[model samples]
Target: MAGGNFMHRVLSYVINEVVVNGLANSPAFQRFAVRTSKTLEDISVKASKKRQELAEQIKEASRNFDSFKN
Candidate 1:
């Protein structure tokens, strides 16, 4: 029924406004967001370092193969 649909929309809007806006207004949530961002950045940097190391290892291996052909 139309009444049920109206109530559903109203309830959904209230929940979105309260939960989303409330968390954004909270200091604890802000701290959590900062920590999560830092952790992700650290992981990204570590991964990039590992990738570069692997690339260097591959280059060294390819050189070994080239030297063997002579």
Candidate 2:
């Protein structure tokens, strides 16, 4: 039982080391990060634009409502 536990820990450590090294050395991962970051930035900009449009629409609607009430 103790041997099994020791083997499990060793395998886990080796796997984690390999994965860390692989990621660190991978250009593909770096490119992926850059692409994902750019995509997120684009989405954020679009969202801000949409929010502004909605705000303007709401203001217009409010003005219309006020005039109706008057």
Candidate 3:
């Protein structure tokens, strides 16, 4: 039973080391990270623009309402 447990621990260690090193050196992972960052930046810009447009529209609507009341 002890030998079996030792072998299991060794196998687990090797598998974890291989996976961690492989991911750390992967170009595909780097590209994905960059692409995700750019996409988030683009989305943020669009959201900012839309927010500004909505604010302008609300201001214009308020002005129109004030003119109508007068």
Candidate 4:
């Protein structure tokens, strides 16, 4: 059981070191970061438009409901 615990700790340490080094050294990470930033910006713009449309729909539904109640 102790051996298993030690091995787990060692493996975890190695994996973390590799990940830190890889991010620090990799060109792929840089490209991914740029791509992700652009994608996020696009998603933000689309989300804002969708939110506005949803608000309009909700307002119309509320007005219709109010008319029916009266």
Superior candidate under lDDT, 1 versus 3: 1
- lDDT at 28 for candidate 1? 100
Question: What lDDT would each prediction earn against the true structure?
Answer: 0.99, 0.98, 0.97, 0.98
Cα-lDDT of candidate 4? 0.98
lDDT of 1 at 21: 99
Tens digits of per-residue lDDT for model 2, 1-70: 9999999999999999999999888999989989999999999999999999999999999999999999
Tens-place lDDT digits, model 1, residues 24-50: 999999999999999999999999999
Best by lDDT: 1
Question: On a 0 to 1 TM-score scale, where does candidate 1 land against the true structure?
Answer: 0.82
* RMSD value for candidate 1: 1.6
Scored against the true structure, residue 4 in model 1 reaches a CA lDDT of 100
CA error at residue 52 for candidate 1, angstroms: 1.0
Q: What stretches of model 2 exceed 4 Å from their correct place? A: 1-10
Clashing pairs in 3: none
Worst 10 residues of 4 by lDDT: 24-33
Backbone-clash count (model 1): 0
